[model samples]
Target: MASIVKRMKLGSQGLDVSAQGLGCMGMSAFYGPPKSEEDMITLIHHAINIGITFLDTSDFYGPHTNEILLGKALKGGMREKVQLATKFGIKRVDGKIEVRGDPAYVRACCEASLKRLDVECIDLYYQHRIDTSVPIEVTMGELKKLVEEGKIKYIGLSEASSATIRRAHAVHPITAIQMEWSLWSRDIEEDIVPTCRELGIGIVPYSPLGRGFFSLGPKVVETYYEHDYRKDLPRFQPENLEHNKYIFERVSEMAARKGCTTSQLALAWVHHQGGDVCPIPGTSKINNLNQNIAALSVKLTPDEMAELESFASAENVKGERSWNKVYSWENSDTPLLSSWKTVE
Candidate 1:
């Protein structure tokens, strides 16, 4: 055997995963257009063949359509090829987004996910977001119960603050922390990264390409479907798009100098964060998926990493990632001390 399974342990619970994981969100809807069922199936099979096994998904995406698509992909022998990870907690109910960490919701969500994924047990189950009103202990306590019952192999959290992470860790060992991290989105590096490294929690980054802003094409930007959320994102605005184009052109130039695609340069830079960091870039097209996975081979030297950092710091990239009133993506708008209360 030529050493196939890419293993990077997430935490104290001994939960190891592939060096690169496949994020299945785009196949359901969020990217731009709805991808065909056949493309999703072929993409899953191709991922297995390339030795990329860690798969990340959530129940809220497509309001359950993505899990159904993944279930279809896992049929027969292909199910054995992945170390599965899925989340529940943040949900959209009656057109209103809510975070439900209630124990009742947890059990119901797991059952629904099981039915959709067609899997007996999920390898890694995460609390997509903490319902601050519910208390971290209460939520993790319920998740702990699931672990004992064999519904999940390990526990993880997403977009949680450092204090929340500490409180949750005290309740039970957190295997990994999934958040948005890239050269463009380095906010997590300040506190979250240090906390995860100190606690041995693996960091899985989503949106490693700055929402395709690196080769960052104009044609690609205009192709967004009506339902696509990126159209509202600050980065995609006409004014910011023009300003950001220069930054991406620089990124493309750097990629050409290093002999790789702009996407590859972005992903490779994310991988450089540390050995414990793994990025799951989602794409519905097989060509994009292939280009993304090939990023693993594009390693940057120490000097190159420094150059990348300096290049990014110098850019006057316009617009925050989110609309001003709503708040920035992968970052907090409310102050750290303020408490979160549920609408219900």
Candidate 2:
């Protein structure tokens, strides 16, 4: 029997989910080679059994295979037990990744995701990335229509600017905003996070474990396979990796003092951030899943929170989160939405 985890509401629209979600991308792609289907299915069942039911996946993951995998696992009455969240808008065309938020694309993606997941409606559907080419209003309007049509239950935006979020929410109620938020990736706190709070939009922090860097230490990057996405990330470069080791050491030392693993300490920090916030950490192993579940109990003191804050400051961390400049649009420090007018 799995333990019961607390639930948190992700938007004023009454979208509530477990305090932590399971990011399913790693099971099908990224990090290294894909895990066996049987193992991935078993892991998801274990997640549901343990009450970690807010499951996250994107259509682009495996380009389409992950949704099929979830569909297979969610069969046999497991579908009703979890809140299924998947993303759209990210596509690989002609060997390059592109974001498409056009209303037509939105509808197509939703329909395809519905078919792939074998679900009547998705619990939460997020626009994976803002297609700067499309007006946020237009995209939100299309999503609004989907809710009315019973294709999706809730709406969300990932890696969108605060202004974009406001614009989208104005068009339709946004249930959640997923972004790269962890002890090391705290830039969203400057504005995006506050904006979510003001709009009653829930904040779901993806890569809350900092893509396994925070949990496995800085040197873990060197162990990534040639095809691993982390290999191209600037922060994982040799020089930058060496520079960022201090962050891992600082958190590890604290975890040791608390008698918890570094990963648990990092997750505890995320859990302590707020009630409306949920962190979805990814893993392909049962042991890591259990360790992450245990983080719900690893509470931190106010002083400890402040200490970790200083240790993980952006100024102390080296290199950009991504090596490709195009991906930087997701960063909170980017220019305001007014500068990047959406296509009319």
Candidate 3:
């Protein structure tokens, strides 16, 4: 019941959160079927007990289940102890996935999340995916109003391009930009990472453990349940999996030399990125959470960082960071505000 994690500023704009966050997506959906609500609540409480309080979730995660679960978990004064974050803009309609970022949808989603989360204000709210058709300014305009109204504390964007980030930040200061940045996922480094650093926005790296690949290694693919969504990702396919296993092997060898587990080393690499960067690594079990938290202690020298990078350099890693091309940062730019017209 003692604090094990440190608190750090996520962005220059006065938003502070735990050094690392607990990603709550897997507890309700994506990785597999829904876990027992009772057990997940216990896991959530345990995370807070150990100081991993920057909890992240999205409305589309279960299409709603995840937020409701967090609402329940944060009851009995638990909500007062954490910096809760949830996202919107990704939805499913008639079995198809869609992303929305218009002012109307933004306001509606914020209201709905406030209700679901049972909180007066959200610590941070993000557009889960960019809506290419809507102008970033328009979406952020509404979010700015929310900030004025005290509906949300700060704005954030996930999987957004450098241009979109600038436009969104011009409308309202972006506290964080959540993206997939891990040993195997380094495409953001070319532009997005630098843009955020220049603009003083924090980087929240989701899937910091390579979606569980670094933790369990290649054979872990065999343990995927029938409904596990990871099975659909190309990197885990038999062909790509064969090629990717070596990256894990090399990382494992380095981890052994570093006196830590492969998962810890992989996460530590992200932690070493800088104090402005925070990685939200998700797990369904307490032991895994402990291992991830321990990653904060696995320091690496510059050579070790570069050597780890060599193992899973983008070219060496197979498959796209996203299964759907549209969901990635490359395709996340929105129309200019000057070119946007509202449909009545």
Which candidate tops lDDT?
3
Question: What overall lDDT, based on C-alpha atoms, would model 2 receive against the true structure?
Answer: 0.88
TM-score of each: 0.91, 0.95, 0.98
**Tens digit of per-residue lDDT, candidate 2, span 1-344:** 85578887777998878889999998878778788999999999999998899999999999899999999999999998999999998899999998888789999999999999999999999998888766788788899999999999999988888888888888899999998888888878988889999989898999988899987887687668757998888888889888899999999999999999999999999999898899999999999999999999998999999999888898998998766645443532232345546412
lDDT of 1 by residue, 1-344 (tens): 23354567666678767788889888887776668989788888787777778888889878788999888888887777788899998776688778778789999999999999999999999888767567677778889999999999899998788888888888888999988777766778888999998988889898888777764554567667888888888777898787777767777789999999988998989987888888888877778877887788888999988877766663566776545422222432222232433433
Looking at model 2, which ten-residue stretch has the lowest summed lDDT?
328-337
Q: Give the winner by lDDT: 2 or 3.
A: 3
Off by over 4 Å in 3: 342-344
CA RMSD, predictions in order = 3.2, 2.5, 1.1
Which residue pairs clash in candidate 2? Answer: none
